[model samples]
Target: MLDQAWFSKVGFDWHPHRGFETVTLVVEGQLEHHDNAGGHGVLDPGDLQWVTAGSGVIHAELAYRRRPVQTLQLWVNLPRRKKMSQPRYQNLRAASAPLVEGPGSRVRIFAGDINGVHGPAELHHPVTVAHAHYEEGGSFTHEIPGDHNGFLYVVSGSVLVGPDRMPVENGHTAWFPPGEPGLTGIEVHATQATQLVFYSGLPIREPAFAYGPFVMNDRSGVAKAIEDYQSGKFGPIPTTHR
Candidate 1:
């Protein structure tokens, strides 16, 4: 998560990533993204950038406007089978995103199902991701698949989660354990006006070897990734993005 007043002169320069997908949510201001695979866009509030750096990709992200920008980025790890899959990008604009409302709560689905309604972006792995807002005393309940592990990140305000009514405060996160062989119903209630993001995904259950921006299965894989990147296999940042 990043919340700051970014200036035009300072930003993330060209960087390389591999063996995972990055999901970025712009919540407060505009974010500009660019990559080597001809992917480029300006994301407004409520927008998302999903980039799969399977084999490798070079990219950059910076503030698009002169203002405060608050964004959250999640890295979805790839399984061993997909560690070297081709890179891809998806720009999910806010205008076409799906929304679910109940009482004083509203949820925007980005990559999952909510009450049988699915989100837009397709995934290599099954995952549920959403942003939600609630007024004081608002409540929401949803079922998560049994095999998935999930968490709720409180962006602001306070809320109670699960049947225990666990209190979660601002800048905190509540984790939900994996359930039994069937669906698990999770409930959330706002003690005060609240904003948060929900993320759930099936566990890969594989050993992860991470170094810098690369994640692999073992030390040898990480070495190979570094050698490949240094040998110019990831390719350079696109000229247009410059």
Candidate 2:
């Protein structure tokens, strides 16, 4: 996950990429996307875009206006079989994602299933991602998968996790290691008005070689990626992609 941790920030000029996936989750104001893959759009709060730069692609993200633009661009590694698949994209808007409310809290599911409900994202891997909002003193409990790697990130508030109600400060990513660990469902309490994002996924226990935007399984794969990129395997960014 990559972020400037600011609601409003500037971005670099357009760039090219390959060998991985980018999931941009907009949490604040607005963001604009332009890419060589014939993609362009403005993302408001709660909007997310998934870009699969399989074989190759070029893309850029920038501020859409003077609005706050806090967004998390997460790169999920691709396995060998999906490393060369055709690039694709899917945008899941805020309204379309499932919203579950409890007392003074609201939880929006972006991917994976919870309470037999699924979010509107399609991806090569199995994972669950969700954003949560809580009023002061609000509390919510969630049933996590038995064997999934799960954790919670405190976006901007104090929170307590697990039965012990471990205190988590802002800007902290509280990781929950796998196994019973005496934790089954997690109960989160907001010491103040708070917001958080939860994640759970099947662990991809493989070696990874990474450079810039490319993430491969080994050194040779990284070298080949560099070669393909220099040789223009990824197309150019169109002037009108924005």
Candidate 3:
């Protein structure tokens, strides 16, 4: 949730988590991150970092302000079976992410494929993540898969989905039904520009039990996780900050 407003100070501190995956996408400047699993890196503009805190892990994200830092942090719930798996990480730079551009529009593929051009992000779930930009009167059609759930977060400007035309300004999100697949038109006035993030993921058919940073399947599982953390099983939190 780090935005353009808070670039002077570090946004988040070292925190422990279990049974979920965190995806950080840097749209503006840089984000430096380090974790208890011996993972550390920076996510620059157009870069993305995926952290799978399967069993348990502690991590922190600090905003690097050589330039303005604007990014999105998404927490995806993991399946029950993979919740106890080992922790992992994947960092993708801007140059490695795939892109598609037309007359007045451009698309950055962050997770899934668009017209057979897939992003470098490796996901355990079926997901499509993309950022799109459009000029005045420009439009692009996103062919969403019928099986996945899809949503759009407006970073700036206005868009038309189906027969409804709505203004999608910064910090707003929109969700769409799975079966409806058509041209999601984004039209900006000549004096305005538009940007939006699109994401779709396969639905987990299992129950979700969320508490603080922990997202598990059952109440007892959550209790056991807290006990494990307090018992020094995942190692004590690092004293030194990265």
Model 1 agreement with the true structure over 72-173: per-residue lDDT tens digits: 888888999998989998999877779888778998888877667689998999888888999999988866787788888988899999888999999898
lDDT values, one for every candidate:
0.84, 0.77, 0.74
**TM-score for each of the candidates:** 0.93, 0.91, 0.87
Cα lDDT of model 3 by residue, 40-119, tens digit: 78787778888888899888888764445777777888888889878888897767778887657788887876656688
Q: Would you list the clashing residue pairs of candidate 3?
A: none
lDDT of 2 by residue, 10-112 (tens): 6645776667788788878888887775668888887888888888877878777645678777777777778888988888898999998777889988888
Name the candidate, 2 or 3, with the larger lDDT value. Answer: 2
Q: What TM-score would you give candidate 2 relative to the actual structure? A: 0.91
lDDT of 2 at 192: 95
Candidate 1 has an lDDT of 0.84
| Candidate with better TM-score, 2 vs 3 | 2
Best by TM-score: 1
Candidate 1 has a TM-score of: 0.93
